[model samples]
Target: MGTWIIDAIATRHDRSGFSCGQPSLDEFLQTRVSQYQRRNLGQTFVAVPQGEDANNHRVIGYYTLAASAVAFQNLPLVRSRRLPKHPVPVVLLARLAVDRAHQRKGLGEGLLLDALQRTQAIATELGIYAVEVDAIDDSVAAFYTRYGFAPLLDQPRHLFLPIETIDRAIDAAS
Candidate 1:
């Protein structure tokens, strides 16, 4: 097992080995981190490292969270009926990727739980309605589903976990 530390992308040094061995993701991270650093729309991108060392600080995985808007009409049936007929402030869980080397060691789950906990804390302060994510593929969608995320619509790969639901889960876990 390894210790995983979650921190802002701004504080972390740029390391090439952080790539999950995927050419597209590597290119995207390389290009976006350079071109869009600190943009409000790009604030969600975050990097996770294995430990304190910068040189050998293998990037196990990363995720992004940002302020987003969601229409009530597009939400899941259970959630839509409960919310007001207006746009809601949402924490967008944009992208989550784990390196191939760290895939099965629960690092991905740790990153997700960290994001959820952070979202919960932020929601407490800023009054967000839910944590929303757009899954990159069916497999990713299924992973979120297992964690209680529900689809908003029939397509476009969007899903959400209401803050209340998260609260309930936390309570249940305790």
Candidate 2:
């Protein structure tokens, strides 16, 4: 496998060739990421081959992070009991996808780790309680569950991993 450098997406990064076998995700990278960024809705990060030149880098995987809130009632009782009754702030992992050619090569895990690491750093200065994700299906939900995410009480496919858990994971990885 080749080395990859994950960073904020730029106009210089080439994304037209990315295909993750998920049409909506593929189309988002190709079309909507910039708009979301411009509107302050989210920021998309991309993983490209490490040695590629500035203008020649091809995005092989990507993830988007956005500021979001979740209703206190949606959280599981165990996680929400100590918090206030209002909505809780969170980092929304809006999208995560690896190119079809790059699937099964551990790139998906890499992207997820990168997102969590970024979330941890941001949480140090922000009021983020957790990182949440809306899995497209049960299989994807399972993937997040394996990494310690807990599903929302009312929506199983909407999962979250607390900042505390992310801290533990990062410390262990280090």
Which consecutive 10 residues in model 1 have the weakest lDDT in total?
A: 42-51
For model 1, residues 1-174, the per-residue Cα lDDT tens digits are 246776667535554666665676666565675455556565544445555577544456777777898887887676777678998789998778877877878887877887888888888789899899988779888999999998887565798888989888877877
- How well does candidate 2 score on lDDT at residue 95? 98
- In model 2, the clashing pairs are none
Those runs of model 2 whose alpha carbons end farther than 4 Å from true positions after fitting are none
Residue lDDT tens for model 2, 74-110: 9999998899999999999999999988888889899
The estimated TM-scores of all candidates read 0.85, 0.97
Q: What RMSD does model 1 have?
A: 2.5
lDDT of 2 at 73: 95
Residue 126 Cα positional deviation in candidate 1, in Å, after optimal superposition: 1.2
